[model samples]
Target: MEFWKNCWNCGHDTPQERVALEFFPRIVEMFSKKEDGKVNQRVWAVFYDSYSFTKCKKCSAPSLFVDEYWTQTTSPEEAKCIAEEVKINGVSKSGNLVHSHIYPGFLKEPFPQWTHDLEETYMVLFWEVYQAAALGLNSLAMMGIRAIIDKFALDKIGDIGGFAKKLNTLLNAKIINADQHALLEVVVDAGNASAHRGYKPDNNHVKICLQIIEQLIGIEKFGDVINEIRQATPKRT
Candidate 1:
């Protein structure tokens, strides 16, 4: 008269009343009509099964039940209209037709821990952006100095001290003008401070790095370049 099942993980014999069912769809259909262009959509069902038993063999925890059941379809014209609405409004008036069934108190059981983990992940991502910005500026300064030395007959400087001295020599000799030389000095100092020492940078440092990179490259192009480097860095969270 009644069917019985066992828990897949725990192997406890489950009662018919304890068994749970859940259903999801592989594809959702969207449609629009030939006559008026109204839209509608429906979920195309995909079957999945889950169940709970009366008790577990190892822990003897009482089996909990969870499942979902539903079936529906939409015509082509109606589906198109629904798609357009989503594009314009960002959310469907009726929630997505696909339904979920879960054990009682599933959110209360699992979500708090999930939320904390997600928050930690986000914070890590935020801190990584700042770190990337610092590293990118240092790289930019090294490249800029190498380029200048190659193009102009500027002497190769061995270390930070030597590089600063050579750069100052070029400035004093009027090979490079005041503003450009001053900018180069600022970039060298900023990069060295960030790379060698542990300087807690402020907003001013970020702004200056952005400006110096733009001056070395074109403003429009460098903005995208800086952004790409920043984005490529792994986020902390």
Candidate 2:
């Protein structure tokens, strides 16, 4: 008997053993086809309660966790719509996904706007990291070391001097190596010159700064972080 086998998501016929369906009608449709013997199939199943966990590329620690799954359906459009709607609803209910980490001082503002800004900063940081990894130091250095620090996690250190001290401490603890340490110093000096002394960083310096960050985090770890951030980032409107 010739069976009409297709992807539960897109209705695209596939030889794969299992088709993942996302909604109730799709699941019912698959079963109906099986029961009527219109299609040759052994099992019609729906994916429910599926959870995905992402691990940090550097430390291999659990970083991001998502615990929700929709019922299977035969429509890819419907599945996509459901996923997007779920994500939008989540953000509306929780403000922003990344905002969950914000504390009282800088992030505690008029709620939604504050959360949106945090999300923007996080996106920029990820872009910077990815550019550094792919294109090397030249690309990242242009943003200036101070800017990177400020954008990434420097405000948490308070003042510029304190930021420099913290970088040194990280280096000393072997959290960052010698090359990264040197790059950090250069970036701080360049940033200070630009911010306090009205001096700007040359293109070469920008490249070097990017390279330093890449070395410190490693490409694989950076990729993992980027993916996690993407997964957690909230959609606007």
Candidate 3:
């Protein structure tokens, strides 16, 4: 069967075609003898456990493969088929896999009102960063991070020369503190290096950028929430 799965190498949610490498099934039979010396036969549940390797068919720059398997069961003839079923789950990658599917910082909820009000363009770029990182495209992911920063600056300060100036303006206006400003400078530089210098950063680099971006977003959109939480939290004696 053909299905879609996220490629760990290419960082793309590509189509995969499964070729059944091995399949093993277990079946049980029960028999009983009647008082009249006649035999009755019945079949219980038929269990199936299968393993297969699928190669992503959607990418051209060498295919990424995943090993997947399923464990399921079908009731006997009378009970009907497909008593329980679960599709293949990705277990391991084919190569030097350093990335995992879990990115806790990935934004799933709607943007906080202030962020949306600031610039809705950032919302789309934020998602693109998540998507690019998910598919293992760190370069593209960094670019998305850069785009988000640019969008935010443009919305807040309008056209002010380049990204560096816009960031300076935000800093001067105290929209972001010194620490936040420094961290964003790293993100902007990393993204710029990727775009202009053809630098493909590692996963850890991209991860730090994603986290900083999340923090910036939280601060920009939900500053009130942060303030309320701080006030509600009790200090140690």
Whose TM-score is greatest here? 3
lDDT of each: 0.43, 0.44, 0.64
TM-score of 3: 0.50
Candidate 1 per-residue lDDT over residues 49-114, each given as its tens digit: 223333444444454443222223434444444444433432234334343232232222222222
Number of colliding residue pairs in model 1: 23
Q: Evaluated with lDDT, which candidate comes out highest?
A: 3
Worst 10 residues of 2 by lDDT: 99-108
Residue 56 in candidate 2, Cα distance off native in Å: 45
Worst 10-residue stretch by lDDT in candidate 3? 77-86
110-152 per-residue lDDT for model 2 (tens digits): 2222223334554466465444433344334344445655544
Q: Where is model 1 more than 4 Å wrong at Cα?
A: 1-131, 134-161, 217-237
Clashes of 2: 14
Question: Where does model 2 exceed 4 Å of error?
Answer: 1-120, 125-144, 150-161, 217-237
